[model samples]
Target chain A: MKLVVHMGVLLGVGLGLGLADMALRPLAESAENATDINDLIGQTDPDSGTPANTEPDVDTPEIRDPVDDGTGNTEPVDDGTSDNTEPVVDTPPDVPVVTSEPEFPRTTPGPNWPAHHVTVEQASQLFGRPDVLFVDARALDKFEEGHVQGAICLPLEAFHGQQPQILEFHTSMDFPIVVIYCGGGDCEESDAVRDLLMPDGYENVYVMHDGWPGWVKMGLPGETGQGEFEGFYDW
Target chain B: MGDKDSCSAGCGMTRWIALPVRVALGGVFVFAAFNKLFITNGPALFNKSIHAFKLDEYGMTEGMMTLSTHLVPWVELVAGLALILGFWLRAAATITGAMLVVFIAMYASVLLRDLNVECGCFGKLSPFCPKTVGSCHILQNATMLLMAGLLAWWGRSAISVDGMLAGKAKAPADAA
Candidate 1:
């Protein structure tokens, strides 16, 4: 009976203190206005000469006049001269304006997506910028095998153990634009890492929707090796 | 009365041995709880650590996670203090033993699933085991479980609060 009473008391005290702590803590920041993608969309980098937003140009079909050769045969022909061709529809079928953007289809977030979801093109634009910091949220093996050129590996599972390293890196910057990525399809590691960082006052975090596979597929710069702080072996 | 007599009889040597074990176990718990509760953004970071276990896939909701985030360190704190002060050694040992069992099970699960997760056992300070989950963590928790078991089996120790209280309660009965 005394053992039961002691157990009850300990549990009751723990629960009471827990409730009090929860009530005292401030509510987490909401997803409203969390994404800064809109602000980033139209901005152009002067040095790179690449426009941040590369929404594909809509193709206009060429309108050719039918020519009659007096044999009652009307044929639409290429005139080989610019006189009959519409100037606006002169883009060659073989060459596209935005060659940097890959043709492969990539997953995109829905309308109500909370995190700042960036496509591979946008991520490529942000890449190598002094203000941007890429974080890989995959396991250590995957990160060491291949990852974005300068991305630091902060696997979602190891975040707590690496908190000091993370804080030191974050504080070393003046609020850098952090982009976190994981394995492309259906991986939530990037979002999970972002969530962990956000509560610690990292506001500029974004998720690469298509992830590392997309980056690699687009022929973006990447490197293979262990990251600086990912010294703990997964095995 | 019976408990005090047993402590004074053949169990005298065992009580002395259990003292250091109880104190050491309590100290470890206290230190761990301190790291989890007092560090900067400790709770939030600990929450992320818990999420890494992917308990959501096991049907644990966000609400349950939040509750655990708040409850675990506090329990550790209270139980640890109780053990050190020897106010309720049996109860404290029972609580910590139960927790160690859970931790060993969690480590085993993580290993079996081949999930590459770091052990958030000591937050950012992993003194005993490697940060990543491995057999070392299971061994460490198992050792702690043994210490807790020893403390629980040998209820009260010499020079303890429980001993003092028991003596005081017995004094009036002797006068009667």
Candidate 2:
């Protein structure tokens, strides 16, 4: 009967699975063992300061998705100020939303919005141009922690309940080109700002993928805290 | 010697396969949904796995992903409940057969793409990713496919309402 044939097939499949699992079990065990032992593969060398007994950080560094849509990303974000001083980027507890890299084939790729995310060199040109206006999308506090020099810090949250405020900020609409960058290539803060600005008729908004980290990695100028950058930090 | 008409439609034969098929596939859904409801970070982990694949790069939207979160569980729950009670056996079998076909296709595509990603299916046994391209998930679905096909082929035989209804219909003939 057909039912009998089906059982027969399922049985064959089960046996094959069992055999495969048995053959692979030892290899699987060894692989896990190696991963457990080698997680700190580089850290334990005598000169390396990593504590040998300490477990490696559970948070794996985000790797580039192999199927990258060509936009560069996964930057170590910082307030524009981190020098050689702070090497490890700590996971900030308060901010739950990480910036998203601008996905291409963007549902609506319109201009007068944050340009499709660009690389370091592309961002540098925009930042260096006198006609360009950069908006830092991190919160005021985060901006204080680090921010690009000459960029205005206008936290995206400002548009939370108030649509009017975003318009007021963009009152100068046409002249200087507006670009927003949040936490570098890994974040999407810049994109949201662009979307908001687009509908508000701000005409031109851009998200810098090589955002905070992009600027930092290139050794560009930035300041920390409510210092000389004060006026621009809250824009 | 040949009552060809009864066998031609296959109504009698299909009923036989439905019982086991419903139970097995329904069990998978029941198991899947129960864990989804109970696990502390089930949705997050599953969503993370989805992102981990960069499916968005392939045009899967956030809305689509969110839709799956709710839709998958509901289908599993409803199908499972009906399957357990042997209620609506025909509808359950047909839908389940369709879903399994989709699963097989997805697995095939993953294999074709050589994507080494967790399938995020059975959530509990699904390995923490950076998983290898070669996966057993395709085989798992193939088995489910057979079950679905078998059930669809035999609508009522094992332990189903279809059989009960057929039996009731035949009772009058026996009485005569």
Candidate 3:
């Protein structure tokens, strides 16, 4: 009878303490903000039947500069600013004018295309690089089904809870680049993950523009099941 | 008189031997609770760890997961303190022993399913076991279970709160 009383007291105390802790430390706002996975997956582009890039193209130059008509008249054009005292001049004979676009296309700030979004081709180039880390933002079941050869799974819904682990792994590896991807076609999970990671001092986080489907479609290295922690401690 | 003396001597020896075992078991539980409850974002990390076991696949709801996440470490804390103070050694040992059994079973399930999940036994401070679940966890928990069983069977030592209280209770009975 004494043993039973002791057990009951311990249980009651534990329950009280647990409830107090829960009440004190509320769940993070991220949990409340997490979008339903089904809702995200069901969304599609009506026009192209692809993931709609509804977010405004912040990468595009909004204001175009007036082109110089090449009159070579040494006159300061009345640019709106009083600080513009010097006249615009053509390039000197010694200087060369290079007019080539960058090797890879840049993405605009949007749900489908994060500012640092990398194309499937670019991601392929960085695949074997030691400085790059791949993170799969898909659900665990999807990740277990198949994922990028060395990607770690960190689903969007679980990001708030699981971020410490990801941060620890990333910091330990000191990977310069982190490329996150989710299901292809209308999936913003990857972008959502990138947004969450940015505030944590990760400036080099990138999202794979075409996501998992694009990687598989390209016949890139993909594997099923979770990969063992390759270089770092298994934790 | 000789037989009585010998039995008393045996009981004294048992209590002395059980002291360290009780303390060690209590200390481990306290440390485990500290890691799970006091570390930065500890509860959240623990919640994730529990989810990795995929209890939802067995029909566990999100609410149940959250409740367990909150409840477990506190229970560890209470039971560990009780054992360490020797206020209720048998009861504390019983609770901790039961917990160890559940832990061993969980580890076994993980291995059987071939699931690649972190043990999360000590949060970010796993010293004895590796990060991943394996046979070693079972061994470690089994060892703790033995310690708990010993405490439950042996009861309290003379150098304990329970011992003092028992002595005080017996004094009045002897006078009567």
Candidate 4:
């Protein structure tokens, strides 16, 4: 009957496509930190399967607490600031140091969560830094409404078409610090974009954890309408 | 030429309306299924989207959710194609209608809970996609459900392959 023929073709196409998807998927390269947030924080190194202990155990210089260096001082003597007189050394080229002024107060003491998280103050400081690039992962309209002052728009919905361009551009730049964000805590687009990039060995990437809403909430500067540098984070 | 009863004005109107509805419904299914079938990481993303729905909260296992994710797209593709072709019109309409009901329920649950996530209906295609379902998503699905119901009620169309085949079969019977 005509019924049998039509059903046959329909099922054939659907099953054929589905089976092809299952079979071919394994051949593709897998992501190093796909769907794993802890990986972003350096809690578990992908290759080692153990906690990456990066803390240094060297002795730090003593603080120069001023209590009138005790020689029956009538007037306080001026100390030219600091206990250590040793000149600061420049960071080696091989090391990827994420340095910033201590602008934000920290109540908790520990290693910063790698480059995965950036506080509002830290993100603000990162502005205008030649090595830092802001990535907006929300839709183009949302990007047009408002975003970080110099952020690149890369909406997850259009990832398929725009992904190649990002991969190529970032690769050429040798992977600068990419500070990515979406609408905010409620939006998962930022995380999705980060996951997409991680497989290709982009390690310097950081998530603007608070997201764009958080930036707005903090009263940070933002730009409205289309950016001159849309899609790619040229700076 | 003497078959006026079989081609009444009411019947003509029903067939004309059914033709567009069937084709449109079929096209939507094909388009939706094509993206789900071919897009890179489509299956994985779909599985994640289903998990977002908190089906696990409803006592569904990970394995069951995984199977549904794999199977649903193919069924939609097949049913949609069948309806468009007007081959086994009644059967195809019934299947499509049932699937629409399931989709409506799923979208309704998402709306009720107020979860913010992609609908995954069109596999990242924008404009057509109701990103993070609200009233819009429910309305879209409801419209599709009505179309499916109408297709089922009409059951046949003069412009379909089903109609042509029936006419050919009747010719042989008449000659005999």
Candidate 5:
């Protein structure tokens, strides 16, 4: 009976400590945040402490002028308030937004194409389409290095969390097609990406059954995700 | 008192060491039951449990889930307390051994099936994450299985109630 009582006490202590440990986590992290900034740099709490980080704005950071002598240390000598500010002479004209209609080939099984896997030739034609929204659902780092031409990087994991902004990016397009694809055959992330835009009543959502390795192996026109936004033909 | 008393003292020391390990192992099963009870895909865990125990022929229904989870935690907690307290040591060791075999076989089936499901041992928290199809960090489980084998093979230490009572009874008989 004595032994049984001791065992019961041990069990109670273990469970009590476990619950108490969870309740103390926030308290511990907040206590850490009150320390030196450099020591507190990498401390991360999934749902807390981020907003209070704004309190570290004690030192005002320098904002530079639009044009400067190549040296970054140069002060804003082009201050507009100068008596010789000279009425803003040699000002550049506002450039008009280009609305060029680039012709692109369309795909077979055009919209709401379910489980009908596309071949390389079919994908190549789809890639050339004007309306197809190709998404590289890889890690951000992997997507940044290379992607299909006219493709955008919205990794499947990150896409789910930021769905509102993602939906708005293509809100104006009519019957827009999004071809989501991931790394390879083993990765089911392409299918996992039934994210906000798909069910938000946008028309077409097709998964590239095979992925980037497949796209590149077929010698299709491809571009790196890393470079400049404009002039991506030979990228 | 000549030979057996000396043996009993030696055995008692080992029982003290074995007690903590048994409690730890039993606690793992208790935690497993707690998760499978409340947080798991409940019907799914029952279906898997039936399959793991090779009870698939009975056609597992939703009704059995409450029974399985309830029985399992109590069994684990009782066995844990008994083993740690050196009460009914042989029975506790035997049951712990059996439980470990069940865990090993369950994970092995998961290995063969290539199911893309986390082993819901701890349910929502720290689910058994498989790195690939049909395999996990298999070595960690293999080590636990080895510990179970050790406990089963050498659980005859005499610090238990069985030894204390048996020794005194034998002493009066010898004095007679």
Candidate 6:
């Protein structure tokens, strides 16, 4: 009886303390303003106190500017803000916003183009189509290094925390056809993000089967270094 | 009576030595649990780390993982506090020791799989973190296990509530 009483007291204290901590935590990092991968397991550089970039050790010349359309649409520039907020992508007036799925030619069920899988060709076809939005499910550093041109960085690890912003961003795009991808073959992050998006009323979602490496291997137009991407907004 | 006095003196010295070990084991658990339970998105992060162990391959479901993520911290917290107070020292030490065993096994599994993910045992307080579950984490758990095992072997200490109770019970028996 004495043991039981002591155990009960300890249990009560633990539960009480746990609840108090969660409830009284600062609201500075709520769902809407939650950061990307850096907030989720990203290590801080002990010397700088800033998140250290965890990008793969593949060095390539940084693309100096965004792909200029010659329509006076200048490149998207990062504000270089200390908060690490992703630079907002300016939607040009000419960019088409599709509210529904579109009819595309070539519907072959190849190994790379299975149902729910978009081949590199298929992804390229959808690229800049205004109806398709590519979502990069890799870490922020990797996403910054190189991604499908115009791809939005919403890493799989931080998906739950950044779900609100993802949903809001898609809603702004009128819920375009979202093609999600990560590092490449065997990287299940894209599939995981797709699973998450489906429950939230996001239809027309497809996992890019080729992934980022697939795009790079195929020599498809790619952007390196913080192109037009939505970053974590630390408010 | 001389033998009893000498034995008592030895036991008293042992208790003093065991006190710090008990306190250390208890303090570690308390700190670990406090971070896991209280930090922002602590439970969710812990849940992710648990899943990274690939328990699903061993037939553990997402629901069970989620339950464990929440349950483990409270168990650690209660057991830790009990050990610190020296109330139910045996039970507390046994529980903590068992937990360490499980932790050691999980980290060993991580090593076998060559996974590169944080242990997340102390939430954000993993000061020695390679930020990955590796040999260091296993060694840490082993150290804790040793402490808990020693506490269990020593039973109660002289500076404890349990010891006071034992003394009161013995006094009544002597008077009778």
Question: Clash pairs of candidate 4?
Answer: none
Off by over 4 Å in 6: A1-235, B1-10
On lDDT, the stronger of 2 and 4 is 4
List, residue by residue over B1-176, the lDDT tens digit for candidate 5.
35355342345456556656666665665665565443324323433434344334346444454334334444555565556555555556566566657666666765666544344455334544442224453554565556555555555443555557667878998899
C-alpha positional error of residue A143 in candidate 3 after TM-score superposition, expressed in Å = 21
Native contacts kept (model 6)? 0.15
Candidate 3: tens digits of C-alpha lDDT, residues B1-176: 32243232346678778777788888898988888887655665677778889988789899888888888899999998888888788889999999999999989888999987776666667788887789999999999999998788776554677777777876787799
TM-score order of candidates, best first? 1, 3, 4, 6, 2, 5
Error of 6 at A171 (Å): 28
Chain B TM-scores of the candidates = 0.93, 0.73, 0.91, 0.90, 0.61, 0.91
Candidate 4 lDDT score at position B121:
79
Docking class of 5: incorrect
In TM-score terms, candidate 1 sits at 0.56
How far is A200's C-alpha from truth in model 3 (Å)?
12
DockQ, every prediction: 0.25, 0.03, 0.25, 0.14, 0.03, 0.08
The list of candidate 1 runs beyond 4 A from truth reads A26-235, B1-10
lDDT of 4 by residue, B54-159 (tens): 8787899977776666777887888888878987776677677777788878888887887765677776564554567677777787888889877767777758
Comparing 1 with 4 on TM-score, the higher-scoring candidate is 1
Candidate 4: where are CA atoms >4 Å away? A1-20, A24-193, A196-235, B1-10, B126-129
lDDT of 6 by residue, B46-86 (tens): 76678779989889997677557767787899889888888
Give the lDDT of residue A178 in candidate 2: 63
Candidate 2 CAPRI classification by DockQ: incorrect
Task: Give the clashing pairs for model 6.
Answer: A86-A231
Q: Which candidate is the best by TM-score?
A: 1
RMSD of 1: 12.6
